[model samples]
Target chain A: MNLLPTEEQQQIVDMVRGFLAASAPLERLRPDKFGQIGNPDAALWPKMAELGILGLGVPEEGGGLGLSAVEEALTYIEFGRALVSVGVLGATLGAHLAARTMPDIAAAIMAGTSAVGLATPRGAVAGDDGIFSGEFHLIEANEADFIVLLTSDAIALFRREEFTGQSERLSMDSHMRLMRAALESGKPLSWSSVKDGIDHARANLLIAAYATGVAEAALAGAVDYAKVREQFGKPIGSFQAIKHKCADMAIAAEVASCQVSFASVILSKNSDESRFHALASRIVAVDAALKNGATGIQVHGAIGFTAEVEAHLFVKRAHLIDFIGGDQRVQKGQFIGADAVI
Target chain B: MNLDYTAEDEIFRAEAREWLDANIPREVRPPDGPGMREFDLGWQRKQFEGGWAGVSWPVEYGGRGLSLTHQLIWYEEYAKAGGPNAELLFVGCNHAAPTIMARGTEKQKSYHLPKILSGEVAWCQGFSEPNNGSDLGGLKCRAEIVGDELVVNGSKIWTSSAHLADWQELLVRTDPAAPKHKGISWLICDMQTPGIELRPILIMTAPGHHHFNQVFYTDVRIPLSNVVGEVNDGWNVAMSTLGFERGTAGMLENIRYGAVVERLVDMARQRLGASALENDDIGQRLAQLRAEVTAVRAMTYRIASRAAIAPPGSEASLARAFFSQLQQRIRRIALDIIGPDSIELPEDDPWIRPYLRTYSNTIAAGTSEIQRNIIGERVLGLPR
Candidate 1:
């Protein structure tokens, strides 16, 4: 059991971290006031695609990075830490998975000439032929070339231009743009009763990775603030309460990190226990993100809750991830059913 | 990032499994019958004979000297075999043995290690005091040095297995003039030593199951050599013991609880039927529980993998915290499924007793709140 990341994996993480630090620094992101997915600067997407991030999970034959889910998850974690757009993750993962079985479409997505977004919650059914019609707040819906409408029965690929109307931009998270769309009894690329299971697993894995990133970012921010922000003639971090809160955040982030990394490894190895690991990673990651984000805000005090502070961005992203893949209740149900089967 | 067992590790697992299957007698497993002491002793001896005891300890110390990964595999198989809970020998096997390996003198190792491995002796922790539950440094248990002997006069509370244990891995204040944390000493005291009194503290949750005792040491005398480390350096020793205690073994134990929860799921299915599972709400709840169990299992493996590669640090605290809360959640879910029947106290009711027994998990290994504090400070690098 090689539990530690390979040298190659570490290099990948370091490269991504360095890239995100330079290209998507918090300072640069702050002015946009949009979180990771909403409205990225016009220049960022193409650069990211050039860096092979958009193709992080795509197969080699599909003109992509050909990395495993574990690698993809880690890349997204960096995205999360940078508070980069959810659109990137959605587009990348949707394309990568699609490419594994649907080479042509995957090739389109990997080339940055096409983008796909998940338009349905895992396990949620909207209509026949895998045409998901339930409520979905699309992150970067306006920019996508196509939408992978995930329904309970199947996953339908929809061409963005086929729709008559345009998606509206929302203000809740400026970085992540939201849209509303309808699928009119569309034909599925593939249909299977187990699609819900696949979606559930994939969604959990993505959210878990995202949460890990957010929690880590929150820790970094809180730790930095504690060291530099002084109160009563000492660094705020010197105070017991502040220290404890920071410690809790660190613990949560560490736990979530280990869980996410482990789940990624499990997925790569194709372990029978992958489903369990994925679900567990999601559960821990969601809780960690929520707690770390809240504690981060608490440690930052008034400054954290302000719109200008990046702390709120972490909190917002955490909440968004929690709902996007499915809530704790939904994840827990998947966990229970899997447990029963095992 | 591979989780598959290496070929060597797979062979090791098979060998371990075969050994356990051939050696562990069915009649000795816990819950098969009462006598936990006999059951634990028997299992430990069986493992010792099979060269499976102390799988991670050095060979010189009567261990297999295997990699921690192999040890983890052994534990996974052991748990899978429905083996008896090793709670009775936990202190000896997990903490005391490791503490001795880390800080014990040569003589201490030669004498204690073999005995511990052979299951000739059992150990219990004597750290907590009536006044210092969470604040362990403030313990009032005093041990005065006089010549070559130490006169120990103090009391330890919540000493689990004290009644059955043969030795006590203890901490006591040795210097009143020094600060609370700096003045203590760690000593291995024989439970049979004179002036050592073990009063079984019958827990309300587990009637007749004497898992804890209040041991009052009144002028208990022991050779000064009994001290594991330097005088007034007990705090560090105690910390090391506590730290090593929260490792893959603990994770395995927690995951075993998940197995129990899995059994509860099976029971629920058999009793509640497919119709109950068909309901969206019920299906969702089961799915969530299934997911959490999977998560815990994954987290446990992650921890195991980390421990296998390096000395466990804050990550262990994270796992402990997560597992404790998850176990409690599992219990709550089980109770929910059982409904009002959970409250019923029929003598033969398995769910009722386990329901009561579950409360002890979070409390004993360190309270959930303390774990949170540890995670908050040590793992998270928070201010405290």
Candidate 2:
């Protein structure tokens, strides 16, 4: 029942971390020649596909890395550390969505040939006549060939052409592009039916794993800056004020990280408690990321506030990941009748 | 990444649940004092007689010697069964007994181990002095070696159960000329020794709760053999038991914390009426408490997963500080939920006592500040 990553799992995390560092460093978040924050990494799709990053959790028999949600979750933490595009999540979950029914599309999504954008469905409804209607908020989806939309209890994949309208809007988080689509379902939408409560838990826990990574990264950055940053002729870390904040950041990150492991393991086991854990883990991880990201900025004094420093990127990504399916506030209500007895 | 329990672990869990269901005391633990002590010891004695006590102790010491996972299961079941808190046995079983097992002489182990495991004796800690509570290394209680025995003088305050304890794990400054931290000696002191006097202190808690005392020692004598380790090296011996204690402390209590949060949510829902879910203050706070408590549970399991629940390193401070603060937060949230109902302690309401008692969460064991220092200097390699 050990929650620590195994040696093999450590290697996988290292491999993903190494891949992100080399291919897409934090420097990429820097505004480019046109002052644009991020450009579509069209080439990364095929490369990640070759590396099996897209379908890591899909069974090997179904053309994936032959891992479980635990491995996939660990990989997403590295993704969070790198501040990689949220579309990576889109592509990953998209592969999972397509695996059972559209095996061909699943292979394409996994192969990285098809870019799948993860979207949040608002006011979404599926009618008895087999029509799905919702205004979808697309996340990092401009370059996506396919968009994945989540209804309350199930998931559905849609072609970019299937949307009635698509538009780009400036978002609070520049690292991940936000778009909106008014979905007017044309044909009978095939809902790749998941387990009754699995869709929310699966997606929420993955998001939580990513948020945990951001929290950890924020703590690391704060600690490093505290050690080197000087104030009153001494490292700021020498002051109990800054040191205690760093300690608190460490605690928040620890609880958040452990919660991710917990939710991932329970989800992997298909436990009845997975939904409850999913909601709980998301709240803890998101809070950790938000708190650590803010405090990490404060720990750096002036430089942390600047866009050039990587500290604020965590704050941005934390919010973006937090609201991928739904913001944590709405998610909290789900626990109203949840297992107070158990 | 694996949380799969063996088939045997499940069976053990079922066994524990079944046993607890059959044997749990019908009465709630008293708030404090003799009744509380008697209730705790009697329950422990029952567990020991039933071969369920000392789940983490090695079999040679009359413990079940179950794996760490088994200890986790046993405690989880114990909490679920509403078992009385082991308030009287903490210093004995968790601190002194483990320290003895690690650093005690054969004779020390031979006598105290069975007595502690059997609930025949209660042990209280005498480490925190009147002014040296958090700065434990700078404690001023003095002990001088004299002809095959040690003479002790000085007072230890905030000693839980000291009034009822049969013996105490005492830390006194042996080599006053040496450095503050280096001069301390840890001794096993008989509570019945001459010149030992206890003054019970009424804490800011519910009425009738007198769980703390200040023990004054004037020329109290103890045989030198009672020292768990080398006389002057007691600082190391005293510190030896904290790792397991800090990392795993309040584990079973965390289950109670979860139940408390659940009960809070129930209370909030009833209080807030139909708009409870939309009520931002109480509703959201209760929801977050549930998540935070669940996170603590995960953190506990992660700590337990350490090989055989092995002594954690400095990282234990991180877990300790988090759990303690969360306890405070959960308690505070209850006060908010209870509103004016909390103005007076009701006989049947469970929230008020814990809410008041949790004030010590960040203060006791180690203050949150000291925990930060440990984290800053020891964990993050920051300068003092």
Candidate 3:
């Protein structure tokens, strides 16, 4: 019944935290004057691969780390805190799904030579003729070497060249450029007969992990600001108003972190309760992230409302993550239907 | 991250389940009053006789002295079997004895621990006073040392079960000239002492549930040996007592809340029929609450697992605050699901009493407000 992370897990967290603190400080997440993101000056892809993050969930036989989902969740939390772009995780997921059938693509993904974009499952339709046609909403579409199309019944992979029309739209997150693809005819070279159950679980778990990261980041922003920002005679944090808000943010982040970690552990074990936990984790993480983001902005006062502050950045990224895996209402409904138990 | 019970834990759980199944009454125990008290004591005695009491207490103290994992398993199985409320014996069995065991003299341990575990005596805590509820350090309850005895003069309020208790784990100001937090002393007060008065406070949450008492001590005298710790170090002693209370009691409360939630869901289904969860809003809220409960369970487990690795501190307060508020939310949802029955005549609806009483969950022990302050100042390192 021990739920405490082993010494190794704590080391992993500290290692990632140390790297992120140095390489991608909170200052880098601040939005620029043009509302563009001012991310760190680092080539993150190869650096992340060098850290074994890109190959975290892939099996060793597939030329990857073969780490458990729990380990992947730990790294994803750091990704959320650093506000790293979603392309890396999308690529990891794509590689994990393609590992058995498309080892070459998996290896390419692990080596950081290929990028994968994940399309929203709403518009895409899979046909029996090994073709998928729909206007797909994609994350990191422009930079993706391959795009993974998700549907209720199956998962299919499509190369960037297969799509005919693509239009990019800006997202709430400064770093994101959301794209919509008008697919003429996409060849599904190899479709995995993945059940909607597993996809729903996977999607929610991944999104929850990212959302927890965002919540942690927002809380950190508020706490850091509260300590140094003075109003009247004392630090604003001395005021119960700010103190209580920060406390609530801490609670939210803590609960979300626990929920996400619990779900990831369940997923790693392939437990019967995995689906329930995943959906529950997503609901909790989404709410926590959004709430923490809003509270972070409030704690920062006027500066937080401006795009220049990191508060809004966490808030915006939280919304993006929440939107990706169905909203809370949808996830809650699924959770109830699943009759999740502890 | 493995939550699976070890084989030994599983066996212990099964044995606990069997014992509770065979002993727990089929009917729900009376909510409060003499019948409820008897039920609680009887259950405690049964558990003691069955060698199931004081699970995590040291072996030298007449307890099973098992692992914390075993204690958690006992709580889970006990809650699942719908064990009677621990109110009647709570202070003695859970709080006082543990504090005594940790800091009391060998004589005190030998005197109190066995009687407590055997349910031969009931105890109440005398920490919160009328004027010093949240500001406990400012309590005016005074005790003056007179030779080998201590003369006490004070009033304590919200002392639950004090009227029925045989003894009390008391805190009093012993040195008025010292700082507020440093002047206090922790003592074991015999409830039968002369010059003591008990006035039960009538509560609105449930009928006949008058467990709370306003106890006044005009000039109660106690032997100096009754002091649990050093004269002026009672603040730390009391805090340690609260720590133990929060850890075991909080974990047990989470498990109990889980069972209560299951019943609430069952009632919801029975009342609303097949379409109960059809309403999207209700469904979403129920599911959200369910998730929150599970998260709390995990949080509790995490805290338990961490307690072994880390030194105890204000971390337990985090779980205490979170679970207390979660209990409130769960009952509110339950009442909402119960609808008009919540306000009906007789007010005997099971959900109504618990829903209203949920107010105490946040207020007692430490207010949710105070808990937030602790988390902010102590846990998160925010400014005081």
Q: Return the TM-score for each candidate structure.
A: 0.90, 0.96, 0.94
What TM-score is obtained for chain B in each of the predicted models? 0.94, 0.97, 0.95
Model 3 chain A weakest lDDT span, ten residues long: A33-42
Best DockQ among the predictions, by candidate number: 2
Indicate whether candidate 2 or candidate 3 has the larger DockQ: 2
Tens digits of per-residue lDDT for model 3, B1-384: 767777888889889999888987666777777677677777778788889888888888779878788888888888777776767787887789878877899999998899899777788899999999999999999999999999999899999888778899999999999989999999999999998999989776655468689999998999999999899889988887676666656777787777776676666667765354744566678777888887887787777787667635786776788788888888888767767666673634667777788889889888989989998999889988
lDDT, candidate 1, equals 0.73
> Rank by TM-score, descending?
2, 3, 1
Worst 10 residues of 3 chain B by lDDT: B273-282
On the 0 to 100 scale, the lDDT of residue A323 in model 1 is: 66
**Residue-level error in angstroms, candidate 1, position A333:** 3.9
Q: For model 3, how does the per-residue alpha-carbon lDDT over A244-329 read when each residue is reduced to its tens digit?
A: 89988888888888888788888888777777787778888889999998999999999988867788888887877765634566
**Per-prediction TM-score, chain A only?**
0.87, 0.92, 0.89
DockQ of 3: 0.62
Local distance difference test values of all predictions, in order? 0.73, 0.82, 0.79
Q: Pick the candidate with the highest TM-score.
A: 2
Predicted model with the maximum lDDT: 2
B236-312, model 2: which lDDT tens digit per residue?
99888787778876678876677777777877778876365543667777778889898888888888887454577
